[model samples]
Structure formats: structure tokens, C-alpha cells
Target: MAGVSLYSSPSFSVLCLAQKQKLHFSVSGDNQNVPFLSRSLASLRLNSSANPLPVCKPFVTRFSDSGSSVAESEPDSSVIKSELQSETLVSEPVKQEPKREELFAVVMVGSRQYIVFPGRFIYTQRLKGANVKDKIILNKVLLVGSKTSTWIGKPVVTNAAVHAVVEDQLLDDKVIVFKYKKKKHYRRKIGHRQPITRLRILSIAGYEDYPAVALSDIEPIK
Candidate 1:
């Protein structure tokens, strides 16, 4: 503002002269000089198109290898079916047969308890009124057991009996009882043999009279 001067530029002189002459611009309807502004816009569009901005290329994903991997991992239907058939074939030979039943019982005969098995002879206290080869039926069964189950009675199993044949009547070894007194000079000796009966078990029956199976009919474990 200190060193500035007026009437220095040509544009300032033209503005002063136009103002003095009272000159002005007026736009009419339908007919106008709008192409001058349109030409400037068109020139701007041409400049933008002639020198375009840099374009970036997008990265692409290839699925060909992934598809191949999926195919390789998938199991074949035919191979799965063949494997099941092979398992069935291998299992067939290992199957086994049903096992036979085993049965026995604990019977009270006279004053002693005896574990009786079919076809086996067991010695018991001397039985009265029983002769050789005579089949004797005992009803004092305490417990009856089988391969799968067992039944125990409160005192004795009712209706369950053991049938045995008398094989022999014998006496046991002698047991000596000696009495002695030192300084008294008194001595005595006594010997005795207990009577016993050897009986062969025939069968054992349950409440329903189902006969017991012997060991000879039972099959051995594989």
C-alpha cells in the first residue's frame, strides 16, 4: 500500500473506461453464447482422457490345484465296499459252538455233608437199611449249583433230591486211644473203626424234576 500506484495495468484501464461509458452484459432467452463455456469444459475432458491416471491390476486366485487336492483326498466308493466285504469274510471262521451244561449239588446224608457229582462215588456215614446196589434218594439238599445259576435253601431245598446207588459198606482206619498215669502204674488201650458207606451218585433233580447232566456229556472248553 505504501509503494503502489493506480492506472498501472491494462485490465484496470479497460475497466475504468467501461465504467465511464456505462457498458453492461445482458443474457437473452433461447439464443446465447454458452458454447464458449462448453468449449472450456470439453477441453478439460480431453486433457483428462489424454493423460489418464495409473490403473492397478487385481490379484487372481487359481483353484485348479485346490480342486486336484480335493479329488486325491476323496476315498473311492469301490474300495470302501471291498473293505467291508473282507471284514465279514474274516469273522466267519472264528465263531464257536454252544457249551454244554454242568450240574452238581451239596447234599446232607446222615451226619455229614457231601459234594456229589453224577457218576462219582462219595463216602458218607454208615447208612442204615441201605443194601448194596440199592438206589437211595436223599432229600436233604443244602445248595444246588449249575454252570450258570445257583439256588440255596434256608434250611434245605425242598423237592430237590439226589439219587445215589450204594456201592459198598466199609469201616475206616483204626484210631487208638491210650490212657496212662506216671507213678500210678495204671495203663489201658482202646481202638475203634468208624463205619462208612460208599455210594455212586446217579442224578440230581430240581424242583421240577429236571435231571442233572453228567460230566461225560459236557463238552470241553476250546
Candidate 2:
């Protein structure tokens, strides 16, 4: 068979022009061009494996309140994680503080004694001449108590007083009275509400100098 060479063929030159591409061809006449094709393919492979073209990656652009702009790459993992953690902390609910209890005392208002605390309100038997917004000084303190200590009066604590203001003059819930007599066919019913005065305890004074007993020092009842 005649040795037909592809080295000088026009098609061979066209194949070489295609850089970084696969090449397929059928050589039926002879194998004389095999060495040349192998050498050309090897050279093409080496050229394809050269350093790749420079890639243009996207960037993040930020604008400040002053109209200044800056470009930056993607945020670091640690920075992004910290931002998420800060958001979670901000989204959480805030805790509320516990309310502190204030001082309280027992005092006699009229014929009856009553227990009262500062900043609290209570209803008592109506005073004949007392009007709403009238300030009353109750000087019959029997016991003064606080979180730290307590003071007890023999009958009434001297120099101790409970200050209160009349908040309202109102009537209490109705009380029903019923009378029945068997076989006499007599029955009577009546409903009535007692008049009462609402007083807001303002302050308990004159017991702060007294000695106090710590709660831990007291033993529980057996």
C-alpha cells in the first residue's frame, strides 16, 4: 500500500487549529501518519493544561450613610455566625425584676383593729364626719413588721402611727335578714348594706428605730 501522509493535509492543519478540543479522524489508507497525529495531540494536550484564564468573581458592594461606597468579598464564616448569634440575642425576651414587699402594720381605726400595708387600700367602718380625700392619722399601731424586724406594742406602740387617705365612701355588699315562725304563718325578709370608707395606707412611721429580728433566726413551729 502507498504511504499516504496526513502531515501535509489541509484537514490536518484545520484539526490543529481547534485548541483545547477533542479530535476524531479515520485513516484508511496507511499508518504512516500515526506518529505525527500522536505528537500533535500530545502538544495540544500540553497547551490545554496550561494555566487557566483569570476568572472574574463577583464582589459585595456597600454604601455608607455619607454616600461612600466600598467593595468587599463574602463575609467570613466566623463573622456571619457572630451576626446570627447577635440577632438571636436581640430577639430573645428580656427578664423582669422581682417586686419587693414593703412594711406592714396592725392598727386600730375605731373600735376595731385592722392590718394595713403601705401603698395598699382597705375598707373600714365609716367615720361620721370623714370625707373623700381626707388624710387620717391612726396612732393606735399594735404591731409593725418589715422584712428584717418587727415591733410589738404592749397595748399601743408609742410614737408609731399609720397614715392613710380616704379614697372613697361606698356601701358594702347587701346582707339579707330572714325571720320565720312555724305554724304561726309569720315571715319577714330584709336586705341592707353597711356604709364603708375606702382608705389607702400611705406610710407607717416611727417604728424604724425599733430592733428587728432576722427571719432566719426564728425557728419554725413544731
Candidate 3:
């Protein structure tokens, strides 16, 4: 009674002892339940493969929509204004003036005429068959200060005086003229000398009558 007690059911005692140990065991059964879990995971994987995730696209900022984007993209207004001003400031071409016409004149002497500008005159030899100086008056003027011959037509300038003296009146040797008719004993001869005079156009009057002919028109006959 003081030492030990013996049990009649040994198996029950062993069971009790096992209970007291609190034994735990990992499941080692066949993979019969695993197929359902595997199938569920496979289904999940198939679904993920079939419906892939959407990819993100890059964002595009339009100038019209955003004020900051517009300001940064556009050119400066001050530079544009300066370019316009430069174009407007261009200079125009200059026009040149026309030239003036120079004045001049012409003079007439006897039947022949001569061109005479300011400060110039001409003295030509008199005609061969002209009459004696004292008998013939050289007052008749053909033209005066006009380009055309019709200026001094029939109206002679009354004071248009001219005096001429015989320069070389010595009788020249008579030149003989002979005409023969094919040895028909017919011949003819004639001889004569010519007279000449040196005319000094004294003073041209009535030149001042026309405003075109001034005191300056009377150039010394040089």
C-alpha cells in the first residue's frame, strides 16, 4: 500500500499515457484532395494569361489646351514687332531733276548765211559777179537770228548796212576758150577777167528789235 498499484487493463493505461503525451502527426494521405486545389490555382493562372494587364501610354500635352505650353512654344511678340518696324522703315528711291536748254542764235549775210552763236562772227569772200561796192548797197538781209530761212523773207532790215571795198581789182590774164568742129575750119574764142571785193559787214542794226537778239548778239566780226 505504501509503494505501488498495478492496473488490470494495460491497453487502457497505454492509451492514457499516449493521451497524456499529446502526440501530433503530419498528414501523409494520397494526393486525392490536392487535384482540386491544383485545378483551382491552374484556373487562376489561365485567367491571368488570358486577360493580360493594360499597358500605360505616354501623355501628350497640346499647346492649345495648356497656357504654359503655349507660352513656351510661341515666339516673342517684341521680336515680331521689331521685324515689322524694320520693314516699314525702308527708304524710298529719289527722283532726279531735268536739265535746262541753252540759248543760241544765227546770223545772215547777203545770199549766203552763216551760223553765229554768242561772241562769234564770220567774214566770207564776196561773190565773184557782184557789182561795184559804191553802186550796190549790201543792205539787203536774207535772215537774222532764226534757224529757218523764212524769218527774214522779203522784209529787209532798213539799217542793215554793209560797206565793201575792192580788195584785189588787178586784171587777171584772160583765159581763152576755143571750140572746134571736126576740122571744119570753124573755131571760136572768148576771154574775160573777173572782179572781186572785200566786204566789211559794218554794223548790224535792228538786231535789238527782236528780244531774241540782244546787245550781246553784236559780236565783233572776228
Candidate 4:
């Protein structure tokens, strides 16, 4: 007699083989806390030999975060300083001229000395001993300094020059009268007309020609 077969069909034999070969999953003591990756670890391995690794960008820290480190990382501070210095060196210092002092001179007229200041007006006057309608000459001068005397040498006054006419005229008003309080007394009056002369001052000489009057030479008039 033939022994009865436990699996009669070929499909039942395949199913029993699959059940015997089924793999049982279990956690190892060392891998209990480890995560399971969906892809195999071998597939995640980088093929460095076939393809070059990507270079990582360096992190840039702001200057406000770390002052000393940021300053150290800055490039070529000395070159910037040198360039600024070179720019300043190219410019030249400005030169200035020395200022000169101004001098002045005047002509002495009558009892007064009329020194012409800057923008002063010039005119003429009559002298003490001038004749009627006669022109008078005046040579009074004040040398401001040594440089202004050269202009004083020429005849500063001229006769019949139109500039010799005195633009302003002046007269004395004081008069003397005689009277007698008596019977048959007569009263008389007398007046005098003072003689006047005209004078004109020419140009002021250079400072060098200025007359030097000593202290003893300047005597007070009585």
C-alpha cells in the first residue's frame, strides 16, 4: 500500500514552505533605542570616489556679535590706511603773502597841520602877508615815515594856480567905538580891515624827505 502524503496539492506544499521560511523580526539589546531607516544603510553610503563631496560654505559672523574677532577677520586695514595717507600727502599747503603796514603824510597850513588821511579832500587858503589878489605859496609838510620824503622836495605851492583859491572865507566881527558924554561933545568911530593872503599846498613828498625836527628845535611859541 502507498503512504498518504501530508500535502496533496502543489499549492499546499508551496504554502507550507513559505510558512517555514518566514523571517521573524526582533529588537537587539544594543539596537533597542536605534531608529529604523526605510532604505538600507549600504544605499546611504556616499560614493566619494565617483563624485566629489560638496564644499561647505563658511559661516560669517557679524561685527556687532564679536568686536575683536570681526576686526581681526577684516582684510587689509593697513592698505586702507596707507591709501588715505597717500591721498592727504598729494595735497600741498597753501602759501600766504606778508601784509605791509600803511603810512600817511600831511602838509602844515597856517597854525594847523593838515595831514591828509586816506580819502581826505585837498584845498587852498590865504597866507598872512599876501597882497591883494596876489597868490601865496606854502611848503608845510609832514613826513609820515622815511618813505614819503621824496615828494616834499619840489615847490609844493604855485602862483595863480586855480587850486590856490580859498573855498571858505572867514572874518573877525569885533569892532571898537569911541563916545563922550559932555555938552557939545562929538563921537567918532574907527575900523580896521585885516590883510589876508592865499596859499595852496601841492603834493606830499615821499617819506625819506620828511624834515627831522629835534626836540630842542621845537620851541614853544610865546
| Local accuracy of candidate 2 as per-residue lDDT tens digits, 1-222 | 223565767787777876424333333222355656654665787777895655444222222422342224555788999999999988968899977576889998788888998899988998879998999999989999887777888876778989999999999999999999999999999999999999999999997666555677789999
Q: Name the best candidate (by TM-score).
A: 2
Q: Per lDDT, what order, best first?
A: 2, 1, 3, 4
Provide the clash count, candidate 4: 19
Candidate 2 at 68: error in angstroms? 33
Candidate 2 Cα errors over 4 Å, as ranges: 1-84, 89-98, 210-222
TM-score for each prediction?
0.47, 0.55, 0.29, 0.24
The segments of candidate 3 whose C-alpha lies over 4 angstroms from its true place after superposition are 1-137, 146-151, 163-176, 210-222
Worst 10 residues of 4 by lDDT: 157-166
RMSD of each: 20.4, 13.6, 25.9, 19.3
**Tens-digit lDDT track of model 3 for 11-121:** 768988887665322111223546555446657888889998765442333434576777878989999999889888885667888643222323345456554333333
RMSD (CA, angstroms), candidate 2? 13.6
Predicted structure with the largest lDDT when compared to the true one: 2
lDDT of 2 at 41: 67
How much is the lDDT of residue 38 in candidate 2? 53
Q: Candidate 4: lDDT of 80?
A: 89
Cα lDDT of model 1 by residue, 97-135, tens digit? 765447778988767888988878998889888899998
Worst 10 residues of 2 by lDDT: 58-67
Cα error, candidate 2, residue 37 (Å)? 51
